[model samples]
Target: MTKLYCLPHAGGTPAGYRTWIKALAPEIEVVPLQHPRPSDDEPLSLQEAAESVVEQCETDEDFAFFGHSLGAVIAFEAVRALSGPPRRLFVCGSAVPPVEASRGRDLRSLPDREFLQEVARLGGLPPEIHADAELRQEFLPGLRADYTLAETYEYHEGPPIPCPVSAFRGLSDGHVDKDGLRRWGEFTTADVTAREVPGDHFPLRTSATFLHRAIRKDLAA
Candidate 1:
């Protein structure tokens, strides 16, 4: 793919894609999608975020997509809303976007320290920062907002995206296994391929080379 749009994990900013961009072949251009935090001026639902992205995506480019964690689902929804589908769509570290209610601890509503501690346990925060009582406090709001976004997300009923789909996962991530990743095939009529890379959930955030490799395989196909 000549142009790829990248989306980030929960609590992630566009800067998270830098290493992923560099790790890719020099011929490919990376465009990171900057999802603004929900504001009173522009409160974003999943569809709203998708709409925002669709408006920015020009019809002429041979665009492909790669999104991790919450970004994966957002990208999925966004592709469905696009007038022209991308060449390929890659999703990692998530299940097929959840439409119904999910069962879990209500992390968003938990007390700050308790919530931060829980996110740490789930590998959301660095252990050192989670341990540093004062330092962890600084990350609370963004982290909470991200988790709340994830927890409350509901898929809209729509026609599936037409692009080829590829799913990737950290080998040991307890959040979603390889099978869950495979289920993404249900959302697309075109080819859906799944693979396992060596790492946990958070590594995909810092380790872009591996993610680049996974995405390149699809481009080569």
Candidate 2:
């Protein structure tokens, strides 16, 4: 049985995949990577965080990666660092070859209110969370830190990976343009495919059946 390592987007907790895991096949062991923060422990640079994931996956039999947004970029880099190849790599809601905005930058410098506004503009955070003052304060710092790490990530130019790559995006995703999504093909030697689902960036929540069928088909191939 192959292991499926799941990585969450910026400001996303491991809990994000709880439902998806239950929906996946039992043969696929799901391991969600936890990003280190000041509250969680010592903070890790994006590269360090990716290295940690590769380290933990070292003992697995066979593996695959599924990452969303910021996590997609990290999963790409982690596979590059691996001692061996994974069975497949699925990157959703993220661009490949690393876009400038996807690289780590210090977004924490922004005023909290402005930061939340910027995130809302990006289309991931819920409007309700933004409306509640207490919830906004509680979630803002972690979101900023995650965005900073993502903005600062630097992509290394290298030979294409030997594994199959699947890039997924929503038809209405405001963040990932088609050209950016197509760039993902350049990273793989195996067949590369791109899919557009029916929702915004977080299509898995609304189109889980479609996502699952597509992934299951790819994994079987």
Candidate 3:
């Protein structure tokens, strides 16, 4: 079986990819990974997160990586850190390319209410959490930490990973336009394929079928 490691979006957990395990069954083993959460005393950095992800993988074996939003950058960094590269890299919903990338805005300093509102605007926050104050409180810290990593990301031009890159963007995603999606091509020497799925920034919710079908087709190839 080919392992398909999945990294989640900001404030997202392994559970986010739970359904993928079943969806891409027997042939592709979906291994959803979690980045470290920030503690009050210490915050998690993107490099640390990438190193942590690298440690979790079986570098000796063949595998592919799929990442969404914030996870996309982390996965790209992890791929760079790997001694052995993945078969392919699927980056979804990320507008910023890895070269000199830094998602604009200081979301880390926004007031709790405003911060949540901003993330919600980007379709990063869940409606259930937004409606529940307690859930919001519980979720805020990690979200902020992840956002910090994203907002502070500074990509130095390094050798592009020796793997084909597949970029996916949601048609209705206000954050990512066609030109931004095309920028991913700069990071890879191999072929780069870009597909626009139907939805807003959150493809899993609005267009899982299209997303899965595209992934299945790539994996099959």
Give the range where candidate 1 is weakest over 10 consecutive residues by summed lDDT: 97-106
Q: What is the C-alpha RMSD of each candidate to the true structure, in Å?
A: 2.4, 2.4, 1.6
Taken over the whole model, the C-alpha lDDT of each candidate is: 0.75, 0.78, 0.84
- Record all residue pairs in model 2 with backbone atoms less than 3 Å apart, i.e. clashing: 103-150, 103-151, 103-152, 103-153, 104-151, 104-152, 104-153, 105-151, 105-152
Candidate 2 Cα outliers beyond 4 Å, as residue runs: 38-43, 100-106
Residue 24 displacement (Å), model 3: 0.4
- Enumerate residue pairs that collide in model 3: none
What is the descending TM-score order? 3, 2, 1
Write model 2 residue lDDT over 118-187, tens digit each, in one string: 7888786866677899988887777877876776666678888878988889889987877777788878
- Model 1 scores what on Cα lDDT? 0.75
Task: Pick the lDDT winner.
Answer: 3
Task: Quote each prediction's TM-score.
Answer: 0.88, 0.89, 0.93
Candidate 3 local lDDT, 1-221, one digit each (tens) = 77999999888888988998998888889999997756668766787889899999987876999999889989999998888889889999887555426556798899999999988987788788889999999999889988888877777778878998889988988777778888888888887889999887778777878878888888777
Q: Is candidate 2 or candidate 3 better by TM-score?
A: 3
